[model samples]
Target: MNPLPQNMENALTGSQSSHASLRDVHSINPTQLMARIESYEGREKKGISDVRRTFCLFVTFDLLFVTLLWIIELNVNGGIENTLEKEVVQYDYYSSYFDIFLLAVFRFKVLILAYAVCRLRHWWAIALTTAVTSAFLLAKVILSKLFSQGAFGYVLPIISFILAWIETWFLDFKVLPQEAEEENRLLIVQDASERAALIPGGLSDGQFYSPPESEAV
Candidate 1:
């Protein structure tokens, strides 16, 4: 083959130099990587504001409801008397104490849920609070059935459990989309950076450039 023309040889040499420069810039600096991570976290923080507010409201309402139940339990008679098959069944001192303890535990759990809401805990933390509340509600329901208690005793806890789950679902719904969007945005940025690294003169002054419109087509 004939030797390349002088201009063509110079052009090829410049392109090689540019390619090497681009490669050097393509490896993201620690500062830039930290900035991107912080940006992603900021996006996540902004996206969850509504969810946090909603969860706070839910926890507050739940706290109020539990407080009301606790107050009512405190005022009620020491024991419950139920009639079954014309026979009266009575719950004694130990039974009343057990019921009181159960209510106290439920109230404490509600307080914990409120604290988690205030702290803006992770989804798993919220889920765990909800799970604990649900388990307590289920236990109450089982105890009510075993004691042949009225459905009135079952209503509040069941309602609270259902509402807790609904709130959790709303929180997940609000947060998951934002998380996915952030991930996708980061991926696009990373892919663009990689592509820019492969192009001659793409990284000049430590900045990557997209192809021109005409060149892209």
Candidate 2:
């Protein structure tokens, strides 16, 4: 049987060494295995640039916008005191963007935890927030007497609905997807390079090679 060419032997050796190191890593634990699988090669680039800023701003705006709408609607509904007397003190929860504002605040804090603390770059966080917000807002729009108020009442729900959808679109289509793709792409690296060689020579693909004097057995 013919011996492997020098380049082929070197490539095989390099591959085996890498695999051996990986095997040692896997023997340790599952966490170590995951860490070594990507070798943290692209961890620093897992998410998009300014992901923290963009996502925080989005949640901030959501909370603020809902609060603004609640304030205006509150005044139109005879101020917070009257509304609380009727909506809360009377053992009934009313819809005037107040509940949405509270929900937005809660959602903001949770999203901050997911993105800033846990460093999740996936769309799940934003998708979940959007879904819940939409459901609540939709239910309120249906049950509430906002249409009897004026243009402001009509516009409030409409704007809130639009904003919630916009948030989903921004994350699912643009920010989160790009970050997720980057992370996934990095994790999808090949086990070994097909063109790797220990000794560099002007060798083209599919060409036969002779063993050099230094590498010959």
Clashes of each: 0, 0
TM-score of each: 0.43, 0.56
lDDT of 1 by residue, 19-121 (tens): 6775666545545655676786675576444445565566567657655654554345332332221222344432232443344346446534543435444
| Model 1 TM-score relative to the real fold | 0.43
lDDT of 2 by residue, 40-133 (tens): 4545655434655586688778778877877776676788788656645564334344566677787778777887778776778877877887
RMSD, model 2, all Cα superposed?
Answer: 10.3
For each candidate in the order shown, give its overall lDDT on alpha carbons: 0.54, 0.64
Worst lDDT window (10 residues) for model 2? 190-199
